[model samples]
Target chain A: MSNLSKPIPPAGDQDALEVEIRGKTFRGADGDAVRAIDEIAFSVAPGSFATLIGPSGCGKTTTLRIILGLDREFDGRLKLPAGGGRIAAVFQEPRLLPWRTVEENVRLALSDEDTGRDLDDLFAVLGLAEMRSRYPGELSLGLARRAALARAFAIRPSLLVLDEPFVSLDEQTASRLRTLLTDVWSARPTTALMVTHNLREAVQLSDRIIFLTERPARMRGVYDITTPRADRDARWREATLPALAKRYSGVL
Target chain B: MAPDHRADATDTALLQRPAALGRPVFGPRLVTALSLAGLLALWWIAAIVADSRVLPAPPAVAEAFWRDAATGELFFHLAMTLMRVIAAFVLAMAIGSVIGIVLGMNREANRFFDPWLILFLNIPALVVIVLAYIWFGLNEAAAIGAIAVNKIPNVVVTMREGARTLDRDLEEMASVYRFSAGRTLRHVVLPQLQPYFAAASRTGISLIWKIALVVELLGRSNGVGFQINLYFQLFDVAAILAYTLAFVAVMLTIEFLLVQPFEAHSTRWRPRRAGS
Candidate 1:
């Protein structure tokens, strides 16, 4: 069991987000009360990458939804950064409007003031420059996911939430996209909290990994990967993953 | 193998075969021309055989059409009927789409109004027209109102189904991005409902035009329907057929030039099928 201590941020960055969820319950179709999240309390330091790791049926996504304000039924308090920072998310599915072109879909996410950001650079980074006029139905799953990522980052969101964005893709495509995700995040790093089940991905992409127990999930443990992102090469991952896996064997 | 029929065919004859797989030898345009010509030939044959006052020959009908066009009476009646169609169609589509979206989104309202929708749907157009005339007294407003009333329930039924099937995921995305209500409706909601709007309009045009004629026949005096009625009373079958064909031609033109092209444009994002 992890204690409820807010992590210290680096100098000059103090507006870390604190999420405290006492309980979350859902009523099944049969009208029985089912607890989805027993309790989850964690703080994501500003500019830090945090990944929520848990089993499939565990309530990782439920917690993410609550924090994103998509579901308000849970008992929780999410203290966003001062000045009410903007939040954006990439859902499990791409969720792009099928009728609109890719450019339009991304443009819809931007507020009027967001026009100052150079969308062309974002498109170039995601390799979606030529795909701006295409419809979502015309793209493959991987390309559609790339478009979804572009929409999320186009807003320059302060809190970027990703809900299993790269799930179900082939290994090659998924790996390529992970590299792109890190590149975009580094270009304009924000406080990001991603929900994924892949432990290796968590090790590669996150500064901190929050482990949760299975259904009616609770924070089981927290691991800090102090290794800088650039040095987490294949050889480093080969050595570090098994040690972390053995330490948090139950949650992993 | 059977003899290669393509080797002997002319270039123009071979034009239709390779462009579309599994299509008939004749192109669609050519088939449409043939079908219309066939109907004309059948009518000509029937006129020759009967040689009666009711069954006029092709030339007689054509002469009546030309006479009406020459006097500009055809244009007058045709314009009057077209105005009514446009007015009633716009009114019914506007009011019905709003009501349908509201009902579809609200369970309580839908339940309360379900019986009313059923009643309106079951009521015959004639009864509505008669009631409107009796209450409002025979006039353009009453006539157009009655036509719209008959068509509103149909648009409501279609738009309600459309609203019910809107994608929830996309809606959530819109809200999460803080899109304004107007923006959400324009980009997220309207695109999803377009096919249903097209469906309602296609059926609305056909249904409203038929009811418009009835309204004119019962009360109004300036439309093509009135002309047909007057010809019927005088036992001038050729004149009646001429007016009927003229109005039908206009409706067909609207269907092709407006309704169908809009439908194709709306669904252009979908993958193409073999024939469509």
Candidate 2:
């Protein structure tokens, strides 16, 4: 089956996450202590998409890192579901190997369960089919971003984490990529956590949006979206943007 | 660099590369031939002006090269030196990379061994050669050992920097993808270190070439260095130049044919700058 069509859940259930952050602190390089996150707790039920929106540098990326088990030096209880499913991430940067061609980069993410059949379709879906043989250095930032997405999705991830995946992109490309992301995402039943600065992106794609406070982040609110992500058209976002903009005017 | 995409590396398959540089049919060899001829012309003129046998003319050196090569002594010594060089290069690279990777990967290890690395880096190559001979006596093993020992610290420094500068984002991507250790090393780690490896190898060959000669000259009875020592005692400047020129020609061949091509291949993914 094309991983582009729909990803098979490692567990019958799409992944569930229960996160609790009491006090996460770290010592900086100069030995000064800083509190990054504080009492920012939230959860995503199986097969739901959630976005963490906060002021820049309010530890949203750090929170994603904590969930992915990349950072352990924190006081937190991040309880992911039991079944061993693949976890995939698209970091803020493309982070692709300059030497490895796009195909090889995607191949590195394949697991035992992955049949390696969806590569072509995945590339085609992400607008990277023709450029699969090119190295990362040979790619533009937009194309590189698509390759990163292809690599993440190639593994048939149960837990999809995107950390500012569309930052620094022009609006046209970002819109196209976001649409591409939502189409690919909605095709499969997977739990996704995204750290984004875009309010419209959160409103359109997320089933729930968790608003976080300033540094040493604490959740201000978590709003459940009634509109189906697939059905969220331009009208829905047009109507939704101003209201949310006014609502988060003080925090954002 | 880019206007000639087809001429350089285009959509060529990387692994099954037939040629290392993918260089176009150009005058690269011709340029080199011209430069060598120029050097020989200048040397011939200088020899004529000096009118001294101490700096023998090109023909005199070529005759010496022919005589030694005909006697088979040149081949034997060259073979011996080549073996020691290859053996030492491999040994130093292996041991130095291991130590370097360890120090780079672990903070505790770096803290413990950094001072030692600095100390060895500052030590003279001559000091290492004499000490190795003193410790192990004048044998082939001691000669090879001295060259490798002198080489290890530099390789370690280079590899350590390579390991340290490894991209953390890529590592996180590897972990998030759950890449196996073997696969990660092959794909994610090794490619990042290619430039550093090239740096180490380029510097290594030049350094090892000089050191191995000294090691041979000091104690060993075979190889280019020992042969040069014998020619020096006889004041046979022609013989010395012949052996030296042969060694130099071989080194230059290795540099152009092997090192230059390998470097080009390693960094092929990098985008070209404007013009040549």
Candidate 3:
């Protein structure tokens, strides 16, 4: 078990989110009490990437929902960043409107039509250039996921929340999507929080990693991935995450 | 379940050769035309067997239709009935859709009015039409109001189901992006409800026309149903058959030309389920 040490950011970034969760208890359909999350607290600096890694059913998605303000029924305090910018989320499913084409789905997030050129560029970058007219039902799951990403980043969100974006894809497609995500995030820097189960993905994409315990979720461990983005390659993950895995034991 | 020959032929035709736009194969159309010819033959035989003026031959009814249409009386009555249908359909859809969305969005309102909706839905169209004429005195307003009231409750039920089935995940997407209410409605809410609207409008038009006929017969003059009643009093069987066939032709035109195309446009994005 890790000790409760609040993540204090640099003195200048004092206004970033310091999420202090006291408890979140939910009852199952049968009226039996289920402890989904016990107690947790952490802080994330503005404009940095943080990944939450935990076992399946550890309520990582729940915590993301709480942060996004979709699930306010949870317990504890979420100190949103000062002067909150726009927030956007990519849920586990694409959740695109089946009737709307890919372009329409992406355009739904955009309020200013002046970003038309940028939208075009975003579509090209995501390999969705030719798919603009196709409906979600027509696209393969990977393409649909890319369309989802386009919709998320098209808004130019200040706080982009991704919940297991690469789940259930072929490893090849997942890597491609991850690379696209990295390029897009680099082009438009935003504070992002991702929930993924893949340790290698957590190590490669995040500035810091927060490991969570199983149900009645609490912070199990936190690690800083000091490898810079250009050098955070597969070798680096192979070299580092196993040692970190031992340090956090079974949480990873 | 009973076998549906049209659907069976269309399905095999779809599989063997995906036609340009799901147009039924020519074989089925020929079959249908022959089937209709056979129906005419049967009716002709029946009229001969009865050998009474009660059931006139098809050619006599055709002559009656030609005479009525040439005099323009049939067209006039059809126009009157159609005008009432259009008015009642629009009014019911507008008012019922608003009430339904209100009930769906607000839990307390839904709780309060759900029972009332059930009560109104169960009320008979005839009773409502009679009550409307009694309360408002056989005026055009009462006639249209009665038809609209009979249709509104059904629309409410349909639209309420539509509102409830709206995807929550997409709503959360809208919220996380902070989309404006107008944009949310146009892009998110309305698209999801398209199928429901399609269902409502398609069925609503059918229901409105039937109720309109009842109202016209019970109260109004110079409409198809009223004209039919007048012919009935005169015992002109050939005229009755001519009017019925003309009305059926108009209804078929509306169904095939208007409602069917709209249905295709709305649900085109989805894949073909079993028989559609």
Candidate 4:
């Protein structure tokens, strides 16, 4: 939901490694072959939270996929930091194994060697201990998303990528999840990138917001969120976030 | 609001503690048993009134059953038939499951064998049995082989379709997590394939029995079908009806006790939908 069109001036500050995507484009299905994403570049710092906001069909999800190595056909050099640590993703859908229990789904993300943490504590953090044995089909949308969050965090990821992970939840549920996410992020600060069109959510959770253009999406803007993460409450809608929303609504 | 209510109800239902004493002894099952007894009494009355040899009285059939049982003829034939069916079923399942998984996993293998499967499925059971007898001779091996061959294609088709529809996301997740192949097969793939295995077992059991009977009648020297053929030669309608009823009873017991229970157990983990 962070829609703004202010160009990010290249600052001298260089605490984090930058992900530079040059001439990145994808071919569409029709013989006409329209570009879905065009040369999008951005940098996310270690332990910093960033959100990508764009109109529907603006290649926000596509950009995330390029980084995840899921879309190798796209043109460009998608550089990651040397000695790239494990990257965990929460897809737009929960994508939980329908046959598996909630705990089993979380356990699926853990490697055999990484066994320092107790699963119960992880489930407790997400308020999902009682629902551990339940299958995905049995869970409500909010609980399913919580389970997904638990699964991603259980990996102890160095980078967490989420694609509209809470879009289907009710406002109250989404707010609760946002608080849980921030708490989890605070506990073990990892570089986080979330894609969402919800401007309030972007401003509430992210350190910076990256906005993209309409269909052949390129970076339309980047806004350094001045709101301190500790002061932000997911329940309250901010007046300034809507101003950014209004600006990008026209450009997108 | 309705979806919220439904979800809350499911959560509550799942939270409820299981009964400590298990299910009560007296229930609808007892009522159903009584109703079945009542039906049998009515049938007995009708048979007495009709005084027909073709539709032999229940007591007369019972007497025939007793006579066969007393002579050990019933056990011998039943055991023989059951052994052949069991052997054929196990072989069919083992071969069918392997072939099915292969076909399911590889598109090229599926395409290669699909026409052959269709060809076998379409062929008459009688022709297949006769061909087996001609090729292998009128023996136990020939009879069992015929039944096994007839059953394999159906099992293969069921298992192949089951394998084809497996959740790709789960497979990818398994690979991402670096789950051992054995663990993935045991916990993930096998559980997903349960319904298909159940379907195959159900269909396979029914088909194998029917085909086994035909094989016994045409090629084998012993078993229920051979005995029925012998009774037909002697014009013993009572014996025939008794044996037929006995087989039907056996089939029903197998369905309720074996197949249904197995199916239910395998699918117990699948979450029930609201209003289901």
| Candidate 2 structure quality by residue, lDDT tens digits, A82-182 | 35467789998998988889998888788745635657777888889899999998888889999998988777777788999989999999989999998
What tens digits encode model 3's per-residue C-alpha lDDT throughout A178-222? 999999888766678899988888887999888999988999878
Query: What TM-score against the true fold does each predicted structure earn?
Result: 0.92, 0.90, 0.90, 0.80
Clashes of each: 0, 0, 0, 3
Candidate ranking under TM-score, highest first, comes to 1, 2, 3, 4
Q: Supply candidate 4's per-residue lDDT for B261.
A: 70
Candidate 1 per-residue lDDT, tens place, A1-252, comes to: 011022323324647778899899999999999899998899888888999999997999998888778899878788875336678889999999898899989988888655455689999999999999999999999999999999998876778899998899999999999999999998878889999999989999999999998889998899988999999999999998889889888544
Chain B structural similarity as TM-score, candidate 3: 0.86
User: lDDT, candidate 3, residue B158?
Assistant: 87
After TM-score superposition, what is the CA distance of residue A156 in candidate 4 from its true location, in Å? 1.7
Q: Alpha carbon lDDT of residue B47, candidate 1? A: 97
Q: Write the per-residue lDDT of candidate 2 for residues B1-276, one digit (tens) a residue.
A: 214434334425465656646555554555567888999899999999999979889999999999999999998998888889989999999899888888888999999999999999999989999999899998888899999999999999999999999889889889888888998898888888888888898899888988989999999989999999999999999999999889888888888788877877888888876433
In CAPRI terms, model 2 is classed as medium
lDDT of 4 by residue, A1-252 (tens): 011122211222213436556555655566566678776889887678999988988888878877776667776665453235566788877878777788887876676555444777778888998999998889998998888888888876666789998897889999899999988877766678999988778888998888888878888889887767776653434556567768777532
Q: A159 in model 4: Cα distance from truth in Å?
A: 2.9
Per-residue alpha-carbon lDDT of candidate 3 for residues B57-97, written as tens digits (9 for 90 to 100) = 99989998999999999999989998999899999999999
The model with the greatest DockQ is 2
Off by over 4 Å in 3: A1-15, A112-117, B1-26, B105-107, B272-276
TM-score, prediction 1: 0.92
Q: Over the stretch B1-276, how does candidate 1's per-residue lDDT look in tens digits?
A: 111233234334535666555546875566679999999999999999999999999899889999999999999999999999999999999999999998988899999998999999999999999999999999999999999999999999999999999898899899888888999999999999998998899899989898999999999988988998998999989988998899999999998788877876888787543222
What lDDT score goes with residue B4 in model 2? 43
How do the candidates score on chain B by TM-score? 0.90, 0.86, 0.86, 0.83
